[model samples]
Target: MISKSTIDKVFESARLEEVIGDFVQLKKSGSNFKGLSPFTDERTPSFMVSPVKQIWKDFSSGKGGNVVAFLMEHEHFTYPEAIRYLAKKYNIEIEETEQNEEQKQQANDRESMYLVSDFAQKYFEDILWNSEKGKAIGLSYFKERGFTDDTIRKFGLGYSLDEWEAFTKEALDKGYSLDFLGRTGLSIIKENKQFDRFKGRVMFPIQSMSGRVLGFGGRILVNDKKAAKYLNSPESDIYHKSKVLYGIYHAKQSIAKEDNCYLVEGYTDVIQFHQRGIENVVASSGTALTPEQIRLINRLTKNITVLFDGDAAGLRASLRGIDLILEQGMNVKVCTFPEGEDPDSFAKKNAYEDLVLYLQENAKDFIQFKASLLVEEAQNDPIKKAETIRDIVQSISKIPDRIQREVYVQECSRIMDISEEVLFNTLAQLGKKNVAEANKKFKKERKAFEVVKKEQAVEKIDVQYQLERKIIEILLLYGNRTEEFEDLLLKENEEGELVLEPELHKARVFEKLYLDLQQDEIELSNENFRTVYYGLISKLNEDDSFVIESYINGLDSELSKEVTSILMEEEKYDLSDWEGKDIYVKDKAESVAQLVGETILNLRCFLIDKRVSDLRQRTLEKKDGNNHEILEEIMNYHQLKKLLSTKLNRVL
Candidate 1:
């Protein structure tokens, strides 16, 4: 367990915007920062971070909380793990008690696999540095590849011994589970025998965006014709190759800072670029480009520059994946090295400035690149040229932005020497074909959805629930504020009608709200709101100065989520720039007393209405036709409602 002092120190030192900005590109919006939702696929910014409050809210997904909550939700870090991450990031020292054996054994399966993967990485790194065989083979290979000691260690480059049982035996003897070992594919188990899966290979640890070791990718050193050269950890609960990008853990911040990502095809390509001072680079790890992988980079930036080797054949095949990037509405540019070189070799040969200059000079938009590459093959062949033009138009059609699609179409027209009209016509044809295909697919699922929609009932608005929620919101925002209020008192007018007369009083918002609710014996109908309300009131009663961050951190996860949601619900409107449209928004702070008074009055009125409803129901259910007492009770409730409504400035 982490000590409270250390956790508090971390919370104090850590900035919510800075932490989340590493994962999502945040742009300034008035007093806060706004960005595309990391938790959802969104084109516009809906994720908000309030530095003043030290909390964040994703309006798209309805997930909101402080920094720790964001880490837990985004990275799936355990509470302790999230604290440690923040502690490490902010250079705060952590004082934590070591977990006992039972505690370690009780870890969940996914966490256990992560532990085993982490252990394997450290063990491999130790071998790479200290073991004789590791230094002689794996270290020598990395050194020959022009990787410095710092670069090697930064990427956690390591080696697995050649012997079959070397890793397996060591892992089992160290109290790590063999079940996790086999599950992570670190060790292969068949029937009753087990052996190292990456024997005689160098290790490259694959990490998530949060820098947790998800799995490993090992490259075999010794030449065996029957054996494959590269092996990746099998799909486990913790690691999915298609969703994981190599070097993302290290490159995320740089990608967001630079507003561009350099995508390559292999692990070495990524590492080499990083070594060459190009930090915003990641590799597909030799897998086909996936939508999940694209989204990982999309969260950070909208621009992607794909680096390709000089091989013409490979470049042709790789062009297919660029379409996927366009489909995501990302601005993609392609750069190729000299005829004999790939990104790894090119970066190794050139100085940092030269490499960067080369990329800047050589990078071409996908349309230009595709047209130039395909135009060569279509030379003197009319049919092939026509097909090439259609192909380029199809790629253009994949772009989601209408304006960007038109821009690319014009570029294609210039490059292929065709009129924009012809290209636009082709684009329209392709769009119709795509929609037709999509409709066909949607038709299959439409019947099932219609059935589900028909079975679903309309949701009703709960008045008491809304009023109770308003009370909680007021307490959270202005509970500590002392304001002047107009206390409404019931008085009989000359005509014998009950009238509300105002009396001025001064009190703290929380004190006023609490007394009003207590006097009326009103309890929040919603369980979550009631729990949070009582807890919040208790905290306010204890201290005149309330630190919302500390209070929220002290609550359990569910209540914490509830409080943050309420606090941030109003912030979404702030992002709309409403004031710029000549529509002024009233600051709730200016009328805290009225806000508190109205909420309480509304709650009282709702309760009285609910009581009247119940009394009427009782009268109807009485089979003996004896409802005189119930009718009188209902009339009294109605009189109370009329009085409350008068106070609320509403005609009943």
Candidate 2:
């Protein structure tokens, strides 16, 4: 168990804005920082980080929580794990309880995998740097490509020994699971034979944007003609090649700082670019550009500048990705190196400032770049020329934003020498076709909801019960306080004799519930609802106003999900509409009124009955009271029963 004091210290030290800002690119919007929702794919920014409240609200996900809770939600961290992550992020040393032997042996699975991967990364990196074999092979390979030792270490570059079973044996000896190794695709298993998957290959650690090692990519050094040149870790739960962009871990800060992303084709190109001081570039790692990967970049910046080598095939291949960038609603520009030179070679020849300057000055809109590149092929050929113009218009049509599509369309018309109206009509038809296909796909799914007085009624009833319980809970929590009620009380006369009073203003519903709960034992099952409910109870104990909205808003989503589901979904039991429909509920919404009358009458009858039983038992035992005392007590009990019966009948 984590100590409460430590939890409090961690919470106090962690700043919500500072923590959330690490994952989200927050820009100041009035009092809050509003940015694109990391939880959802969005074009406009809706994730709000409130520095004042020390919380974040992702409007898209409807998730809002304090810093630790955000870590818990976003990173899937357990409560203690989340605290540890925050403590690590803020540089706070952890204080934890000493665990029993069972707990000590039971390390968290995800953390264990993380530790194993991290250890493997360092071990591989060390071999790359220190071993003669690594120096001869991996180090030589990187240095020959212009990567400095610092850059090698920065990326955790490594080499796998040519020995097939070396890594697997080492990990197994250290008590790491072969199952995990197989799961991460670090080792291949076939019919009880296991070997290192990246044998004799240089390593590139594939990382999440937060820099955790999801998996790896490796390149074969030997010129085995039949062997694949490069191999990536198989798609595991942690790694998806299409969605994972190499070097994003290193480049994200720079991407956000520069407000632009430089997209590249290969891992070495990324390493070389960073080695040359282009910190914002990320690699596609040989996969075709995917919207998932592009949107990851778009999280940090809306503008992407794709760098292609000056080779003819490179330029041709670059066009394939441009359409995807536009489809994602990103501003894209294309810049190519001179013939036979790539970003690596060009950067080695020029300084960082010079390269950035070159990019800024030479980068062209996709429309202009495409037209300029294809213009020669279409020159003096009307058939190909018209096709080229339509091609540019079609790319423009892929953009989802109407205004952005319009602007690009106008630009295309000017460059292609086509009339604006004709191109507009063409783009419109293309967009309509795309929309029709997408709508057909969605509608065929047969998932639609209509409000035809249909509801999950049991859920509604559960919610109404919860509200009445809330009132009951409040009354029980505050019952000690003086409360309003129509109760008869007895007053003392001058001679210290009691006089019966007709009415009294005491026993508020809150007070009654509080006292009753004090005399009873109960526990709330749901933890979050329990906390807020208890908080309300304590306040009512102090006779303060119970603030529901503040409590609801402050709760973490798991709880808010329930409470909001309760408050928002509860209807029909309000009773006013039933009355409007001329439907008289026998009890109407009068839980208290019905229970109150019934209970008073039942108690009156039960007491009259109990007195008769008690007198009978005691008189038979010949204890305490004789038949005369029993007669007086019975007569008095009958008189009290008459008053109770009259009051109960009147109320009912």
Q: Which candidate comes out best when scored by lDDT? A: 1
Candidate 2: segments with Cα more than 4 A from true spot: 1-9, 78-81, 95-101, 104-112, 312-314, 439-443, 446-530, 536-557, 560-652
- Model 1, position 317: C-alpha lDDT score: 76
lDDT of each: 0.91, 0.74
Query: CA lDDT of 551 in candidate 2?
Result: 51
Q: Model 1: which residue pairs collide?
A: none
Task: Give Cα distance to truth, residue 238, candidate 2, Å.
Answer: 0.8
Worst-scoring 10-residue span by lDDT in model 2: 567-576
Model 1 agreement with the true structure over 1-652: per-residue lDDT tens digits: 7888999999889999999988999988878899889988878789999988888999989999999999999998888889999999999998977888898677788888888999999999999999999999999999999999999999999999999899899999999989999999999999989999999999999999989999999999878899888999999999999899999999999999889999998899999999999999999999889988999999999999999888746677788899999998899999988898999999999999999899999999999999988989899899999999998998999899999999999999899999999889889999899999999999999999899999999999988888888888888888899899888888889999777889999998889988888887877789999998898899999998898888888889999998899888888996787888989988888888878888888878778887888888888899999999999888877887878887678986
The clash count of every prediction, one per candidate, is: 0, 8
Report lDDT (Cα) of residue 527, candidate 1: 97
Considering every candidate listed, which one attains the maximal TM-score? Answer: 1
Whole-model alpha-carbon lDDT for candidate 2: 0.74
Q: How much is the lDDT of residue 279 in candidate 1?
A: 98
